[model samples]
Target: MTPTIRGFEHHRVPVDGDVSLHVAVGGSGSPIVLLHGFPQTHLMWRHVAADLAAGHTVICPDLRGYGASDKPAEAGPGTYSKRTMAADVVALARALGHERFALAGHDRGALVALRAALDHPAAVGHLACLDVLPTLDMWDVMHGVDAAVGFHLYLMAQPPGLPERMIAASADAFFGHFLDRWAADPAAIPADVRSAYLRACAAAVPSIVADYRASAGIDVEHDRADRTAGNRLRMPVTVVQQDWGAALGFDAASIWRAWAPDLRHTLTGHGHFMAEEAPAMIAEELRALLTR
Candidate 1:
């Protein structure tokens, strides 16, 4: 028999005077915050969170400007930075009575997790980054045809009004294109989940584009500052990624080592959406990371 989904409780936690997040929390035990990436919602972690919740409390939040979260029209200096988003995660955890927790994030979420680990080292006990590189290295390594892999990065990185306007004009096509291209098996994403994600993206087009735009601008500055200051993720770090470096002629582990000294890097054959495509493997990785 399929187990009943205990479902999730909606939460509105203030991150700043004018900003707050729409979070979903369920289960009970040691807290484990699962953050979703771009073109998806916290619902992406439904399978993994349900499994983890058996032994741990799971907190899943739609990052600012995505899903059910507030989408502020203004993208101020601190508004969309990963650093600020990380702080939102910390605030959400604290509001939920978890001063410290194990944190894991995929794609864009991984970037926020990394920033959280750096910004609030005392709050994140363990860190797991799935399928991303540090922002600067990601930009530094891309070139010519190889850069085509992340074409959206360049498109969304463009200055202000244009990118958002274009994306907003054809939001479903813009968001669905990545959803279709990145998944190894589209069937892994259920119909409802797909529709939900597309709807969220359509509704949060400006903020979504702003989030990526920051990655190309302020986020890069933050990563550079961290590197220059010799500040690395000061926690046990587990990274699961496809061998993008091998395809593009670079050392993936070496790149990760620059940011995470206590690192366990695994190259999986899984596509970008490892959580959905390979739940068992993703769970196994998370279990080992949390245990270690």
Candidate 2:
């Protein structure tokens, strides 16, 4: 069953080559696209989207290989690159008559938002990232002991076949691990929502792993290239994350500042799933971003 998202109107919109994203659109006014992270679908934005919809046209979509969206076969490298996913979002917004829009993303989705803002500077009005770092910084911050905290990163970073097979063998338990640990309060994600996430992730193991695979490989290359080219998000960017850098022995703000000049760097105690755990707070942060 498709989990309902209150007042959202669902659509299967074409993005590119036989790929049509399952998008949930609501409200009116300036458009704001919301992208969900790993192990969850567009449903992750239920509260945030609904709240934002009161004053913005909220566009929520199950990213390329997630949720009810089309999961194309893992054809090759860069297939699930954030660049392609970002392009898919740009197209989705343009299709909805939004030449430019505010964008916010969490976890994996934040990576997409980062890439979108960097790649399509003019098309993104504001960019908000929740609980994540750029791909290169993510790898840099995970040295030695701290790497253990992101064991999934190493697992998915492995070359193809093994990661897919291993994750498949224990999909629920593996996916459920984050759904359990990443949230400050597990109850933030209702039981039904958790079940739906596990089910969707388990069923799309290949595509899901591919999404992570791209991150470990091509995404890092892209980030590196952007750094070499002195490219950064030219729009207003807000980053809200738990101060994991202090724990990981890395400088989060400095790293983010290098990429976002006009940046609102927030160090939140909220968990990784902040959008779900604290919708009102997330909505408020987004409002601040839009107003900037």
User: Which pairs clash in the backbone of model 1?
Assistant: none
List per-prediction Cα lDDT, in the order shown: 0.88, 0.91
Name the 10 consecutive residues with the lowest summed lDDT in model 2: 1-10
Number of the top lDDT candidate: 2
Residue-wise lDDT of candidate 2 within 1-292, one digit each (tens)? Answer: 6576789999999999899999999999999999999889999999988898899899999999888899998898777999999999999999989999999999999999999999999999899999899999998888888679899888887887999999899999999999998889898999899999998899888888888889999999999999999998889999999999788888788999999999999888888889888999999999999999
Best by TM-score: 2
- Alpha-carbon shift of residue 120 in model 2 (angstroms): 0.7
Clashing pairs in 2: none
Q: Local error of candidate 1 at 78, Å? A: 2.0
Per-model TM-score on C-alpha atoms: 0.96, 0.98
Model 1 misplaced stretches (Cα beyond 4 Å): 1-6
